[model samples]
Target: MLGPETLSTPPQSPLVPVLPAYIPPDVDMDVVLAEVAADGVSAAPADESGLQRVVADAQQQGIDLKVVVIDTNPPIDTPLRDIATVVAQSHPDATVLVLSPSFAGTHSQVFDRVTLEAGEDLAKTGNPVQSAQNFVDQLNTPDFPWTGLTIVLTVGVLLAAVLTRMLQVRAKSADAPKPQADTASADS
Candidate 1:
């Protein structure tokens, strides 16, 4: 029941549950930024030199990638994505990847939201370096045109149905017997 007056620091939002957006209090923004500024990858959660190597290679390839691996979530129920967003505010132009124990989150200026979400899906290996490797690998994979393939398949099925219907009609008409008119009546 701490009121605003009683709070020594800025109050956290129950809904957003994040810091005031300038910087998140639970996370050491200075350390994250400093590590990223040094070699494009943070030092925590990924002490393995392989993640740093992967990030360095990505940077060399013009990816402008920065990775942050948080060993734990914030003090509140903050999403890893929110942390990534906070990092993004500091560097809007660089792609930031933030990994947690069970989830991945990212924010990027060089990539679209779809790609970022896809990267997050690929980056949930629970190992920071593996997550980063999977994300980078996904970038090189070409997109298959599922929409176009679906359209083609639909049209083919419709065409086949129409051809079958037309052939059935033709066969029925050919098998139909011609009427022998009034000749029998005249003979009678």
Candidate 2:
């Protein structure tokens, strides 16, 4: 447990970077969350406008997505995913995209971790606006439920095998000779 002695009021690094010189740990999540709550987008002054447009459109389409393109990361060896997590705390059901100059972190209540990674795999990088736009498009693209299909196919195969074995057993019993009536015993 952290005591008041450990609590310090040091200011968090600013979310907007005058220059990309600042890296992870410099991210102020409060500002990010506040901006996202207010505008659905938190980025440079110029980039936020376009990004907000895309995010708003997505929201109107019933897509709960919040984008935070800060020039920052975690307090310890910042990872971009952590940034997304901080935002996710506020909007647990929303998909979040946290973009840095060189890294992208993401979290989604609707998407699995692999799906989030897959989205980042094809999403634009470096340019925040473009990246956010690409992410919107990615969200709109439906992922084929390969896992579900595979499960159904596997179940079908197992059922077929069981049915085949049962039929084989029934046929074998039918083909076997039946004992003749014991007429001698009955006469005796």
Candidate 3:
């Protein structure tokens, strides 16, 4: 037979293990480009001629080039625009991607207008060179989910402690000595 305290105690569940967070690898331009190309088309042209060559070659290969341009100015330069136009012309499905470091606050407004008109996606890089490198680095790291696991583990620990305490109290009560009652009788 169990006492009221012991009978009312609930069974505790096992502790849930906590998993570590995964940090994603740094971004790699080569790998990124390769992945893009593998799915459809890719190109990295250095100069005007190279850009044209890549555009023409990608067209022949039946792939739409995805241009990634990184600059440090606002509104974009005429030469850059010309190159983008050439690429667009060669591959009608191509997208002119632009990343600029100088497009912040007031400068960004100009970028937005140009990007909208040109049908391009312009992202602010903060610092073109460093940002590019950082992006690549981020791609190279691993990613992990930590917050959810921590919550589960914390709950399990709390429950385990409560159950241990209850068990101890139950055992102590069952082994405790009780007082004996005595009766006195008078002689007749």
Q: Pick the candidate with the highest lDDT.
A: 2
> Model 3, 1-188: lDDT tens per residue?
96666446666654422222111123244553453454322223333344444445544654343444433343433333443443344445554433334432111121234333323222244543333333323322334456778999999999999999999999999899875555343332
Residue 138 local lDDT, model 1: 74
Whole-model Cα lDDT of every candidate shown, in order: 0.76, 0.77, 0.41
What digit string (tens of lDDT, one per residue) describes model 1 on residues 1-188? 96667538777766563344433455687888777777777756536488788887887777877788877755432456676776777778888888776678788877878777787789988788888888887765667788999999999999999999999999999999988787978998
Q: Which segments of model 3 are wrong by more than 4 Å?
A: 1-98, 102-125, 151-155, 158-161, 164-179, 183-188
| Clash number by candidate, in order | 0, 1, 23
lDDT of model 1 at position 66? 79
Residue range 1-188, candidate 2, lDDT tens digits: 96566656978676754342333556677788899899788888989888888888888888888888866434432356676777888889999888877667788888777777776865647788888777777777888999999999999999999999999999999999998999999999
Q: How do these models rank on lDDT, best leading?
A: 2, 1, 3
Candidate 2 displacement at residue 48 in angstroms:
0.7
**Candidate 2 similarity to native, TM-score:** 0.62
